[model samples]
Target chain A: MGETSARATHVQHGSHIDTIESVDAVFREQRKLSFAYGAVFFVVTLAIPAMSVWWKSWYAVPIWGGFTANYLFVSLLYYLFLWGLSWTYIKKADALDERLSHMADEIAAATLAAAEGGES
Target chain B: MGNLNIIAIVMVIGLTVFTVGLAIFVRRFTRTTADFYLAGRKVGTIANASAISGDYLSAASFLGVAAAVYASGLDGVWYAAGFAGGFIVVVLFIASALRRFGEYTVADFAFGRFGSSRIRLFTVVMVLLTSLFYMAPQMYGAGTTWTVLVGAGMFGLSPYQTGVVIVGLIIMFYVMVGGMKGTTLNQIFQFWWLWTAMFLVVVFAFTAGKFNYAKGLEEVTAENHRDVKTVTVAELTADDAALLASVETAMSEKGFAEVQAVVDAGDPDATVGVLIPAKNKLHTLRDMFFNEPGHRYNAFDQFSMVLALVLGTAGLPHILNRYYTNPSGSAARRSTFWVLVFIGTFYILAPIAGLAGKLIIDDAWRAGLAPANAAYVDGLLLKSDAIMPTLAQILGGEWLMGAVAAGAFAAMFSTTGGLLIASASAIGHDVYEKYINPDAPEARKVLVGKISVLFFAVVALGIGLGIPAVGLDKAYPALIAMMVTWAFAVGAGAFVPMLLTGIWWKKTTERGALAGMLVGGLGSFFFIIMNILKQLGHLPSEGVLAFVGSLTFPTLFTFPAALLTIIIVSKIDGQLPKNVDEIWMRIHGTASERHEKELGLDKVSTMFGNSKH
Candidate 1:
């Protein structure tokens, strides 16, 4: 079980702290990044079938031998699209996590310092 | 091929022996519940990715994808792409958060996130149901592959029954003995074996079978797509004569003569195998072609199925459980990326094997050189599901066929092993340890987990046996792929909505998650049962029940409906778990990760280390 999840407003790992407000900021950023990529993924994925169903050329007309646009895209190219999307998403996400880790520590330190100064 | 291929049987036996031996060897490492269920969280990125790929790619990808492509054309190819594309959802939306907020199983995540015993129990039921749905097809594949390989029964059991019982028992024994660590190692090895087998078959297709991709596809598409079936004379000659003329047009004279001779026998119930032109379900007016859409799916299904496959992946209990094996959230994300690359390559090769079969098998059959074990109608395979082994035999003969046969069993073993682990954890960890007896010793808990595996394996064996009796094997073309998609639909409906909302939407209440799961999960169950019953002729085709049953995949409707229900119900309820802030930090926070990084705990270690538990 996560110790933080036991009802603390903050999770401290050594000196690094995840205050509720810090995590909320991180959450908003992550949500934005994830949803932005998610929008593209769903659009491209759903569009394959949408076009296959509605557009004649997409499903019917063969561009290379018997490889219709739908057949070619679904069978071959869509994977490249996935590989590209996931690869870039992971790189960006890892970078975001790294950047936010520092920001979260700063925010937590500032909170702790303010409390100490006020008490003195 | 059903004929006694000594080499293929020997290969399969050899693989089985190796798998069992590996399980026994890993049995010593099985100590804590974490070790038993999550491999002690020591798994590396690439290795975990390999295991995840093996767990994800079942007999559905190995046999069903090619068979589906051979049978349904463009729509069939979606099975491959949809499957590989699913990891996108995992990496983007689910993987990192699940790993960070992780426990052992999906049920654990549910309970922890929602903070309730009620939700946990409900999640456990959904987990078990989802596992069984996925396991059913693997069981079916076992029987089908066994019939293809051995061609005989043992101890008075039919060949299919022999396969089902033996496979079920072997997997049960191994999973019980080794636990998750053993399963993870085996999954990595099995994944490579199957990937190599698929690659070899495709390579053989190009080199030995002399197949050219675009040209071969063009050749196959030169003729209209057709379906092969075994039909009784009465049905064939029934009002409107739906099948009589088309049989003649689609079949060769000799093939049609076989049907004609059966008709001339004057037995109304006499069955004959024949080929008939396929109908376009999508367009309705266009002729079905080998390269065109809608041999199996209509427009609604085309979208629904893709949704099910992609979204449903994030919801699968077994796959979700794999995320916990990762050391950190970033590692989980990296593992998913590797998984996509591994499976994407395999998916690309599968349809080529299908296309190769379409181009090569008919010629081999005409030459009277096709493997003798497979049934054929007008040079078309009687059961397209036999394409993997059958095609392997034609291209590279016994050696290649043996490799593919072993690969098929590996697929079943890897997947069923994972599902058994997931199902066992759902009961043993989520139910027994948490609710029944929290103070039980580790050994007792391990025993209970093993017992749970035994129970579910028996259930899976029964499902394998029942498939043939209920005519489910005949109810759909490429039955393995279709059935797996049904499992995906259930997962997508049940878990994706809840997980997506629970992780992403903070306002999501327990009542909302439960309501969403009930509607999405049970709704999918209802629709699937109705669809199966309708296909098996146990339901009417003219009423409201029939209309609901006609939906081939319910994810398109069920997913959104479930999501909306969650929002509305949560809005009305307006209550949240008291520890919501802590839960939020756990889900989105990086302090644990930063702490781990400082202690160098983020670095993955070897699971084979001598420190048991």
Candidate 2:
């Protein structure tokens, strides 16, 4: 088992040309997802203040269950939105990691095969 | 002590003993520095999530958020939203990277990243300052809890002083003995207990009060007027006197007589007759009871508060330290996800409790159930912090009050434990082990950490005792909440910009980090000082100084300023460390990749010897 693992590490080290690019691709993808989710969060949260300033009377307009839009939004819906955003981000980010790892392994195997073929 | 409720005292004692016992049980496992500091990096998602929730939900969340909601309606919910919203930012940007770049404390990370002792020292100062500021409010909350629970001082101390000392000592004993492993377990237990106790109180309140959400909303809103007692009257100018006369003329002659007598007696500001809310056009019953922003903040203030809270979570040292204990970067993200769930559940219940306090306790007080000396001003229960305890007593009698009181202690104790550990680690690990004695053994480092815990606890106790004497207790009605915002502002200003830049910007130099921290930390610190002075009447209250001082949280300005400073200074410095790329790889790379790079396959295999091949 030790000899097999050592040979695997040697192969991985010899064919590391595409690893940096693969890692960068994953990082960029993750950053984009984070930014997109972050923008949505900021817009929803900042709207509370914006509506308060620009449309003051809207607060008094009753919404569901006799709660004014501002009341229900601040008290209930805001928390729900946060929880949803987190759940989505975690799922997507984890998938991204798994994809990146798979890509790394495939790249290493292809590189190893090419190196062995060239040697033969 | 005789005036202290027996049930509350017993409950408080029992909870304290239970926490101490848990700490003692975990102490045997704490044999190494890693165990003492990061629990040997063995914390799982659920345990760490609960610990994070316990650490994060301080007295500010437990008591202050409810009281704010009770006082300001929807404006109060903004506090809770801002708090939980901060973690979203954490989940997106900071949590995983922080765990991957794992260090014992924030200062350690800064030092490792920048490879500068000066940066490390600067970070240590900021960490200590932020921790102390954060801990101060918890100490005050503990004091406030005792005043409501026991009603008397112990061992020649005032009740507030006695409470602060007792909490500080108990926390010190546990944290010093158990370290991270023990403290984390204690926090998990405390969080659940507090959550369950609060859950029970809310259930009881909803049932006992027959609080139909729609009807309660209608009932509160339909009563367009609130009764406010005159706590103090501003001196009446000629115009004011004219206004008073006109107001009095509008009232019945008998009602006017009471007002005239107070004005005639020369101290109109004295605690006198109640102001009929119907007389004030600005405070219609609809506005008083309905959710609105202007109750506590204008649009600008509301925006600034949300900004402070969202950015500030990234900078809190206690919260940041928890990320270091995760086994992998992925685990860190999972834990943050759980933190969001746990905290969201807690926050959802907070407003329920606040509404119950308003619908039940404050309503009863207005209906003549309040003690004669209990003050009500501008629709505010003066002892707003006591609303939860009062609600408990009214709904389910002494036993419920005791339960709620125990929860309050749990909130304070858990938060204090986290803060104490953060500060002690800064002093012992960052300052002592890293600088003073780099070759110190693990046992000696742990010993030093224990001493640091004791020293800081005493300091916190002293500052807690002085909070009331400095008149903060009177100047700020929501004293706990106010101090907490200050801590958040300082944290956001000082740490957020540096951490963000260090992680994302390759050009973040040691010089830039130091300069940004100074600009942000000291800028917010200055604002806090000015605000305090203005509140205590040392500064003019009606001019530019007052306006600047009134920007109680300077994060809205300081955060941008700090970010700008870092960008500009890093541009000017035009230098990056050689290892910046490697560090970036560590921060953004997978845990498997990191293991491959840092250790060969042999080491990796050895590290995961128990795992399946």
Backbone clash numbers for all candidates listed: 0, 2
Q: What is the DockQ of each candidate?
A: 0.86, 0.35
Cand. 1 TM to true fold: 0.98
Q: Which TM-score does chain B of candidate 2 obtain?
A: 0.89
Give the per-residue lDDT digits (tens) of candidate 2, residues B472-521. Answer: 87676567877888888889999889888887676798888889999999
Q: Pick the TM-score winner.
A: 1
For B1-613, candidate 1 gives per-residue lDDT tens digits of 2478899999999999999999999988878888899898999999999999999989999999999999898889999999988899999889999999967888877888888889899999999999999999999998888877777788988888998999999999999999999999999999999999999999999999899999898999998899988889998888766778778998888888989888889899988888999999999999999899899889999899999999989888999999999999999999999999999999999999999998789999999998887788988888888899999989988889899999999999999999999999999999999989999999999999999999999999999999999999887878999999999999999999999999999999999999999999999999999999999888887999888888999999999999999999999999999889888888988888988888898998789775454
Best by lDDT: 1
**How close is each model in CA RMSD to the real structure?**
1.6, 5.1
Q: Which candidate's DockQ is highest?
A: 1
Query: Alpha-carbon error at B251 in model 2, in Å?
Result: 13
Model 2, span A33-97: residue lDDT tens: 88899899999888887886667465766655447788887777888899899999999988887
What TM value does chain A in model 1 reach?
0.89
TM-score to true structure, per model:
0.98, 0.88
